[model samples]
Target chain A: MLDQLIYLFRRVFRNIRQSPVLCSAAVGTVAVALTILAFFSLIVINIQSLAAHWSEEIQIVAYLEREPSPARLKQWRDGIEAMPEVAAVRYVNQQEALRRFKSRLGSDSDLLEGFGAEILPASLEISLREQYRNRESAETVVGRLRQNPELAEFNYGQDWLERFEAFLELLRFGAVVLGFFLLFAALFIVANTIKLTLYARRDELEIMALVGATPWFIKVPFLLEGALQGALGAFLALGGSLALFQFFLRQGLVALLSVTGGDQIVFLDWQQQLLLIGTGILLGLVGSVLSLRKFVRI
Target chain B: MIHLYNVCKNYQKDAASALHNLNFKIAKGDFVYITGPSGAGKSTLLKLLYCAEKPSRGQILVNGKNITRMGSSHIPQLRRHTGIVFQDFKLLDNRTLFENVAFPLEVQGKKRFEISNKVYQALKHVGLHGKLQKYPLQLSGGEQQRVAIARALVVDPLILLADEPTGNLDLEVTLEIIELFKKANARGTTVLLATHDQEMIRRFPRRVIALENGQLVNDSAP
Candidate 1:
């Protein structure tokens, strides 16, 4: 077995050394496809993370009649926050609301002069926990708030909420679909390119078979070469994706789309980076296997 | 010893049989000739012996083991005990003569030193040991054939199967190769030479098997 291993290694090296062009062509196509996959995988991870954070920050506001009794407000607050899904609740008086609004606008006093501070009605601002941050959960809380006698009206950003829900669903669905196409493209590209290279050396393989080489003697080296190609291609893909991401950020490519801020355009974290490397390696190995399938005789 | 018991091989169209009920046997340490014209099933017979193609019916045995149902894995083992020299020479275009001759011993897991020694000895036996580093294309027709013979003999196989081993050689070179086959048989390696060289056969004949239209019509001692 040891001697066979040595001989197989020598044979693989000789083939590659003799046919450098063919080897590189196989390896190159695999790398290109893997890089595209790694890039999108990074996008999916960060989008998922940001979406989770968005759910936490999302909430609804329930405004009440002027100067509700402290006891009634307390009762309403307890009822709202006591629900199974509510995360937190806070009350803001109209005066406090007006003061906060004015502070935000900063000297745009003409619009406010026509209306008194009363225009800014106090409301109970309710925040949901991560689990209950979708439209149904928000609506459930609103329904409960409307039943309270002291509350005059309740409003949540319905358009924004629906859009958010749709966008999140779209990202997840798009990522999956994109991932499948990218993965297929990766495998197909690499497999065929490697096939072309292997086909060129069909004579060499036929000669090997004639010399009484056992099944393993022919398979192991090609498998090893495929593995090596995958590892190298995977590494190259990781680097390529990172470079592309940096370029995207510098060019502010996401700004042309619907996004919050540059801060939210998150880079790939540790988990994401690990996933990319794993993916790259997988593409590399799978591509080579597909290619070598027809090349190596049983 | 190799024995063909009514061996018959057939393909789709051209003939009902490439080799029809061919019965013969070549004993160990024997040198014999299979002399026939082209398309006379001489090549087909050699192909069957090496397990390259299966005999359509009847049993064929090598060293007392039947090869009609032998698995591909066993073909190499059977082949390890036998060597074949093709008319094309079948040397790797990029490999040197040394690598070509050393291939069989290497396949047998012989150590580097043993392989080098065996290959050198085989090459010397053919008187072309000095051209060890040259490629196949760099050598003349006769030299390339010698290299192939050296490769076949390096493992010291029990049987030597030569298919037109000297089809392209001139009179002088053909005599040299015939001498090589005789010497190999003298060393207890049975040789089966397939050829149409009537002049060579008349000069050095022990036994001859003549085939015409897939029938073995003659096997007479000279």
Candidate 2:
């Protein structure tokens, strides 16, 4: 068994070395396919992280009907702070609201000079707990807050959050569908590539069959070739992704993504990288097996 | 021993039969020749005996076991004890002569030293030991056939099947190949040589099974 294994390895290496062009074509096709996959994988990973981060930071601002007495303001703050969903609440007085509005007006502050503090409503800025940050949970919390008569209006940019969440869901679904299509496309490409290799050596394989070489003798070497091609392709893809990432970082374009505030896009972690490599190898093996089925009768 | 009872083969459905109702038997260590003109079912007969193509209509027995009923998975096991040399030489163009000859033993999972020693001996027996590293394309027609014979005999198989083993060689090379077959037969290997060269048959006669249009015409002893 060991002898056969050693010979099998020798034959696989020799077969690859004997036809470097065909072997390279197979590897190159796989590399190009996997690079596309890895690129999308990176985008999906970062977008998911960005979405989660933004969701955790969602805030709500509740405008007061009028400037409450100091005791009434304290009571309102205490009431909101006591809610299970409320993480923290900050009280913004009428003066502070007017100051903030003027600062935001910048060059137009002169237009706001005649405006009194009453023009800007005193509000309570509410931060929800992490668990209450999603669309459904935030809506539920807003429903609970609306029961208070002291609040004149509730503004949490809910429409923007809802749109963002919907868009994120669509993007995720699209990524999954696209990922599956790319995988099958890669499988087909690799299968045809391997079929070409099989055709090139059909006569040799026929001779092997004549000489009593088992089906496994013919199969193992080709399977190994597929796996090796997959690994090589994965390496090529990893290199391409890393090069692109470094280029983006060096150009200082990471901030333009607006996902992580200039933070560099993280490459696949060790486990993810391993999984990617394994997936590549599996694709190659499956492709080769499918291509080889028709030829390996004996 | 080998036996064929009413064996028949057709390459395609509704096509002419390649071999028709063939029946024969050869004892152990026998030397036999199957002869006829082109398309005489000479190659088809050898192919059937080696189990490359199934007999579409009857039974074949080797060593008293019904080979016609053998499963596809067990075909390799049957082939390991049987050697076949094709008319085209069938040597792998990409492999060295040594590798081609060593292939059979390697298939059996033989150790490196055993394969090396046995392949060397087989090549030496066929007078091609000095050209072990040469590829098939690099060798002459006679040399390639000799290498193929070495590959076949490397397994020390019980039955050696040759289909036009010397169809491409000149008279001198043909005699050399015949001598190699004679040597293998002397070693207790049953030899089946399929050919159309009557001159060689006249020169070295044995049991001749003649076929014409896929039917057995005559089975004669020299």
Candidate 3:
């Protein structure tokens, strides 16, 4: 078994060496296909991270009708915080609200100089838990909070949040569809490339079969060739994706898309990177199998 | 031993049979010749023996096993113990003589050292051991045929089938190639050589099985 493996490896390398142009073309085709996939995946990954970041910062503000007694404030805070959907609840007094607004205005703080603390309503800032940060969950928590007579209005940017949620769903659906299409296309191109390679070496394969080579013996080398091409292509694709990602970052394209911050725009994580390469390998193997199914009988 | 019982082969549904119903048997260690004109099923007969082409009817038994109905997966197993040489040499032109000879043994999954040793011996047996690094195209026609013979005999197969192996060679080279087959036959490998070269057949006397129009016309064996 060990000898067979050794011989198989030798044959695979020898094949690659003898037909460097064809092998390179195969590898190049795989790399191009996978690079497109990796680039799209990087976009999806960054967008997902940005969405999670925005979701993490989702806060629902409940404006109090009148200044609550200290006891009542404590009750409201504790009650909201006790809810499973709520991560935390904090009471912001009129003075603190004005101070936050002034700070946010930065160099334009003078524009709010005439405004008094009473102009700003005292409110409860309700931050939802990670799982409850979506539009539906936030609305559910809002509906429950509306039962309190002391709370006059709730502001969680409902219109835009709903739109953002819809847009995210659409984006997610598009990504899935596009990802699968791209994968299928990649597999097809790889299969054809390997098929061409197979045709080029059909004579050699026939000779191998004639020499009493078992089906596995003849098929394994080509399969390994595909796998090696896949692996190399994956590496090339990742490198290309990384370079493209860095280019996008330098061009501020990712930063422009980022809601949290420019720095939050990042490449695929190691796990996702590994998954992309694994997909490449799988594509190559499947492609080889597809071509071999028709071309090789022995 | 090989046995054929009413074997027939047709290339297509409507085409005439390449080989008609025929029966014969050869004991182990027997060297036989399949002599026939072109389209006389000489190649087809050899092909059937190696399980390349399935028989349309009847049974073929190699060493007491019915190979006529053998599964495609088991064909390689039968072929491992059978070596076949072709008129075209079928050598990998890009590969060296050593690599060509080592191919069958490699298919057998022999160890690297064993492959190297056996390849050397096979090439040496063919009188081309000194040119292990030479490619098939680099060698003369006779030399390339010798490489093919070395590759065939390298596995030390129980049955050796040569189909017009010397069809491209001159008389002198054909005789040299015949001598190599004779040596292999002497070593107890059953040899089935397909040819129509009457001069070569006359020079090296062997049991001849003659065919015409896909039918066996004569068998010199008693």
Candidate 4:
């Protein structure tokens, strides 16, 4: 069996060497299709990470109508912490809120020379659990907070964040559909490419069959051909995508995205990359098998 | 050993049968000739013996196995023990002569050293050992046919079936091809040669099973 496999491998390489044009056409098609898929997949992965980072930073500020005593503030903190949706609550006194504002203002801090700690509001900053970070759940939590008589004003950055999430969801859906189409295109192109190869060599295959060659003996070489094409295509796609990704990084896209306080863009992780390669190999094998169905019968 | 009983083969249900009900038997190591004119079902008979085409009716026993009812998976096993040479020489144009002859032994999954040794021996037997690296088109029609014969014989099959192997060769080349068959038969491989060349048939006398109009008309030994 090992000897037969060696012969099959040699035949596969011989076929490729004889028909370089067809093999390149096959590899190019797969590379283009897989590159498209990898591009969108990477986008989806990073966008999802960005979305989660923004959601985790979500918090609501409940300004108090009057400054409570330290013991009363502790009681309010304990009450908010008991709520299931509230992950944690911090009592930000007027002094602390003023200091946080000054830090945010950075170099413009001198412009606030006349401002006093009394001018800042003492508020309860509420952080919601992951499950309650969405717009509807946050609104529900805020509605109940508004019922508190001691609260003067409630503020949370929900409007723009909700819209951003909706846009991301739409983008994700489009990426998924596009990914499906790319995979289909890859399979179709590989199948036809291999079908042409099979047609060109039908005489040889017939002769092999005539000489008592088993179906596997005839099939293994073609299968190997397809797999090699697919893998090469996938690597080509990876190379192209990696180059494009590097281009984006060099152009300061990572800095641009990081300006909003989220981490820089990430490429596909090792596991996802492995999955993509596996998908490439599977597409080649399937395409070759589909093309061989009719010819093998002859 | 081979046996056929009431075997029928028809391509289409409404068309005339390619082979009508036929019955015959050839013992082990028997060299026989299936002689017929064009469209006499000579090729079809050879195909049936190798499990290429199933009989429309009746049964065929090749070495005591019911080939007519053999499963598709078992067909390869049946063929592994049989070798076939075609009229067109069916040589792979892109492969070297050595690769062409080495194909069958490779199919058997023999070791590389064994396959190399056997292929060399078979090519030597056909007197074309010096042209191992040559392609099919690079050689003459005679040389190509010799390569095909070497390919068939390299497997050392129990049964050798040839379908008008020398139909395109001249008298000199035709006799040379027959000499290879004579040598293979001498080594105890049962041979079945299909041809309409009466001159060649007269020169190399054997058991001749003559068919005409898809029916057996004679079986003679001279």
Q: Residue by residue across B49-68, what tens digits does model 1's lDDT show?
A: 88778998889999999989
Per-candidate Cα lDDT values, in order, are 0.80, 0.88, 0.88, 0.87
Task: Give the CAPRI rating of model 4.
Answer: acceptable
Superior by DockQ: candidate 3 or candidate 4: 3
How much native contact recovery, as a fraction, does model 2 achieve?
0.81
The model with the greatest TM-score is 2
Summarize candidate 3's per-residue lDDT along A1-298 as a digit string, tens digits. Answer: 7766777798899989988988888788888988888877667776777778777778899999878999989988888888999988888999999999999999999999777899999999999888888888888989999999889999988898888778788888888899899889889988998998889888788887887788888898899899989989899999988898787642465556745445777777889889978987888899999999988776
The deviation in Å at residue B32 for candidate 2 is: 1.7
In angstroms, the error of model 3 at B174 is 1.7
Encode model 2's per-residue lDDT on A181-296: one tens digit a residue: 99999999899988998998999888888888889888999999999988888888878877876676423435645543546457789998888889879988998899889777
TM-score of chain B of each: 0.97, 0.97, 0.98, 0.98
lDDT (tens digit, per residue) of candidate 1 on A150-259: 68887777788788778878988998899899878877876776677678777666656666666666666776776667667777777887798888742353564356
State the DockQ of every prediction: 0.46, 0.75, 0.61, 0.48
Per-residue CA lDDT of model 4 for A48-105, tens digit only, reads 7778877778888899987998898888788788888999998888899899999999
Clashing residue pairs found in predicted model 3: none
The Cα RMSD across the true interface for model 1 is: 2.2
RMSD of 2: 2.3
Q: Kindly list the per-residue Cα lDDT of model 2 for residues B1-222, writing each as its tens digit.
A: 999999999999999999999999999999999999999999988888788888899999998888889998888988999989888999988789998999889878888899999999999999989988989999899999999999999999999999999999999999999999999999999999999999999999999999999999999998
Q: Is the docking of candidate 2 incorrect, acceptable, medium or high quality?
A: medium
